[model samples]
Target: MKAAHFYLLLHVFSTASVLVNAFDPITTTVVVSVGAALGRTIYDYFHERCDPKWISFNVTGLEVDLENKLFGQHIASRIILKAVNGFMSNVNPKKPLVLSLHGWTGTGKNFVSQLIAENIYKEGMDSSFVHVFTSELHFPHPSQLDTYKSQLQQWIKGNVSNCERSMFIFDEMDKMHPGLIDSIKPYLDYYDKLDGVSYRKAIFIFLSNAGGESIIQTALDFWKAGREREEIELRDLETLLSLSVFNNKKSGLWHTSLIDKNLVDFFVPFLPLEYRHVVQCALAEMEARGLRPDQSVADQVARDCVYFPKSERVFSVKGCKTIESKLDYYT
Candidate 1:
């Protein structure tokens, strides 16, 4: 009887131990599940806050009309529109669309970029996907070059990784630190994958006055040689403009691999506007202001702008930048 009782006690003890192990701590299990739930919720909240929703855009007839309406950049305008249209058509492209717009002040470099943003995005200038970085505003100090470099890289990677179709416009690129500009080279690379980011569907536009002189001189040469302004092709100045932008030490992209690799698909030159284009601008502004555009007013506004080659006939030097402001004087 004692032996049987001992065996029974042993079995009971073993069963109790197994039961204890199986249900060790219900509270611990509940706490772990709740912790995991909270962590996921926090992660989701930040992810939604940080990453914007990007809508697929289509090239519409209205955009084409706007391109035509842009004055004095016949070849450049066509090239920009064609590249954007083609890029937008492809849902997943193998490469990004990189365009460098080089020209004189007020020749519509910024204006063209804005027009593109307005047409391509539903939010127009306020689109979250359209990021415009100005040199003086975004990266002003030379001492902050390294900081800007890291910030720029993160900004590009973050935005592009979230939405590959994002558009980045860097205005006054001629004034940005060369090092800061060079920091963006990796994003423009021909790689299919880069650091968990695919930048093939992104669009980058660099606007600057770096190659303005070369472009203006080329146009002047064509003018003096009796070549029609309509006959001017971007190929006429592409090689020279690229060389000028790259070789110039003051250029934002000085010695950039992007320039060396021919990675920039287009160097769209905004030629200096002639007197006629300025008149078109004045009329457009007047119409926009609810004033009936007058031919004499437009002519006077164009005439007031200072021009180069003072010995020869004058052209609109500022290309309608101040045309709207000057219209008040005429009216």
Candidate 2:
């Protein structure tokens, strides 16, 4: 035991000596540069491997890594599994899965997709079945909208013949051409078999940023403002009416000022988990990565966004209230 201890001490001494006198100044400089390059390379590697693949920085001021950090705790895995099962069960002959992205103000459409992807895949889900397209910037290239319709219809007829339900998730669908809405009218049938096709199958999901009522409300606001400002109400209402079913208030449509009931039903909006929920998730994610929430940063984030993190209620509520109390009240 004494001899073993001696050897261990000697080994430790040798390691210390090696570290202390490893390199000359020039050699040390070269080594540091090389090490920095290697560090950057490793960081890049991890960054690419993350679920979002977009998080380059960490809350703790350290490098963020997806492949290393996002193991076994991703949330999206369950969603896809359930969606797959639902599609498989309801579909007599397994239809192509089409998931849409739709939500209104403060919705985390991209983040939701990332969570689902991270849950299932430590790396990334095979994107063939999963497409993450942003509706915000997808301005159709000239006549490409027509081309997309034709090709999609063709694909549906040819490849997706066996699929009972096709799941298509579209986000910010309001940005898409109005005519594009009419294109997918054929696939609306899920329970009823199409003509001679002897199967009940397929899910078509269209996620949009514009909700039924919000759009109506926004338009109404515009119309009201226009009336007040002496602008053209007819043209503005025409644009709103173009998308909605209610024309100057119809059967059960005048609930809100922005959108009609029929248009609301057309693209069912997937309600977002609240802003507080989003901040909570982000905070939790940061905490999981070893960044203890500092009051200064948390306060700034809360103040900037008005979103209190609910995951750590004690922290968020206390911090927000404290900050609020500091502000001078009006006389």
Candidate 3:
């Protein structure tokens, strides 16, 4: 007999035997009938369907290292949490909010954008503190900043309406010129405006390549010291951001070398230490995805990544201060 027929026959025999001896006929009849129906349903449900991979909080057992790296504790998760928490904290029971994220290249800044939005927005598909009104933001070529700027302005003005604490993140923002920065000006609009781009809730984020100049310097040094032309263009973003000097007292903004701008150049500097989180997060993400970065080959690249430590900060161990940690990292 087939599996279903066998199950039905066995259940019928068991029920007949139970009824023959059942002390309480009313309860036994009801119970045996329910068991026969449930078994058939369970078999049909589990027989041969593909298991769906639904992502949820309990899915990944790898607990996030909140304080995992040097720039400070919980740097990456904080940027995500800040935007999400801000939205969740103020979401009215009756309204909707929006999130906008932009990325330049290499940093995988787009990944974190998804994480923040997914975690908070999961509360409900249609009603949550945040929404992915536009998930990916792309800048036009650096030469045509105005064209892209006009497009961005229209996108922001159109998507965000009637909400508070919206977030706009410009990932790998270091690539574009300062001119694009003006697209987002402070207004009563929901977007978070920084430099000139906008997102909701007014918390504008610009994720740099890290140290533009330093990365360039190291890349040049690697080329001259010397590798062939094949390795000049690096495949990593944090390494590029780390090479650029975050301060301007000595060498002016790194982009100035690429673009002939005469502004005070606070566009890059005004960003807080959290920007480095973008770099660290970028690194952690690569490891998670099993994208093998050749460390020896990337030594120059990694060197450029951490070259932009602020004046007030240095490598230190618990209860001790030292540059040895920095040396250890490079070595």
Candidate 4:
């Protein structure tokens, strides 16, 4: 035990020394040191292997709970769940699993992303291997495009090199400047070798409201035509969603080679939530708060939500975005 502790200290110190010498900024060096330490801690906990009990936990249970938790959009939930299972099943993939989630303001894009991270990562959203970058938070200034580009690339490369199974989530992709997302093209490239970084094992997720209008329109059309919501399959809206995302000038990947190269594995569309979905969202919030389920409160919260299309009554335009606050206010 003493010898093992000594070896661990020696290894950590040696790695920290290398990082300190390589990075000039004390902050960057410190971050690298901390990351190294965390990596060692995680390694010691799992003994250099992923926790099987955690990884192999019943995904079906996750799917069922997500279905109950996230109101409506059953198709989207199933598709995403299946994709996650498939991607994680691969021990080492040749190409990274890239998922672009497109929908409206509160259509569960961010919520579902968090769900995925939480289930797969032991630390949930706080997992060191999971990195989230919001447009306004990380690359707020358009003028710093060049700096952001280099920094983004280096960040991905460094993290992936450290842990190939790293997951990268980019939120508010619509708010990101055009041409900036291309900086990540090399990592998402199919060549298998980019700047000596093997990005194949990494997972990339982009959340955006770019194709919200189109998705809502499709759903509205279906509803008006008296078509069952269950019939709306991925085939019904995949092309239009992808085109809208690529054509939208405000999108980060607008006119970028990432779309042209067809690197994105799946374009999951989160449709607008209905009144019933809002009620479910309310119930979910209530359950999360450890409060007993109350149909009256759920109905009240759902009624308080604003729906879209003033002329024609549709579902909650913002999905469950504001339902929590409303639930709190009501209950």
| Per-residue lDDT of model 3, residues 47-165, tens digit only | 42212211123212112422342232222344444434544455241222222222223323444544443443333223223333221346535566678768766655544443333
Relative to the unseen true structure, what is the C-alpha lDDT of residue 51 in candidate 4, on a scale of 0 to 100? 46
Superposed by TM-score, candidate 1 places the C-alpha of residue 237 at a distance from the truth, in angstroms, of 0.4
Residue 152 CA displacement from its true place in model 2, Å: 2.3
Against the true structure, candidate 4 reaches a TM-score of 0.83
Q: What is the Cα-based lDDT of residue 30 in candidate 3? A: 74
Which residue runs of candidate 3 sit more than 4 Å off their true CA positions?
1-73, 76-83, 91-111, 123-137, 140-143, 161-167, 187-204, 211-331
By lDDT, who's the top model here?
Answer: 4
Worst 10 residues of 3 by lDDT: 314-323
Clashes by residue pair, model 4: none
How accurate locally, in lDDT, is each candidate?
Answer: 0.81, 0.40, 0.39, 0.82
The best-first sequence of candidates by TM-score reads 4, 1, 2, 3
Displacement of the residue 269 alpha carbon in candidate 1, Å? 0.4
Model 2 residue 44 lDDT? 63
TM-score of each: 0.81, 0.41, 0.35, 0.83
State each model's C-alpha RMSD to the native. Answer: 15.1, 17.0, 15.4, 8.9
**Winner on TM-score (3 vs 4):** 4
Per-residue lDDT for 112 in model 4? Answer: 83
Clashes of 2: 34
lDDT of 2 by residue, 1-331 (tens): 2777656655654554455358888776766666566556545644433233431212221112322322211222233345534544442543234444333444444444454443433343342333333344553554677876676565555433543222234555555555554554445433244554422343344444444344334434544465421232333333443345323232112233223212222222223232243345445444655767454454345444343234422112222222222321210
Residue 103 CA error for candidate 1 (Å)? 0.5
Q: Can you tell me which runs of candidate 2 are displaced by over 4 Å?
A: 1-102, 113-125, 132-139, 142-144, 157-167, 191-202, 212-275, 287-296, 306-331
Ranking by lDDT: 4, 1, 2, 3
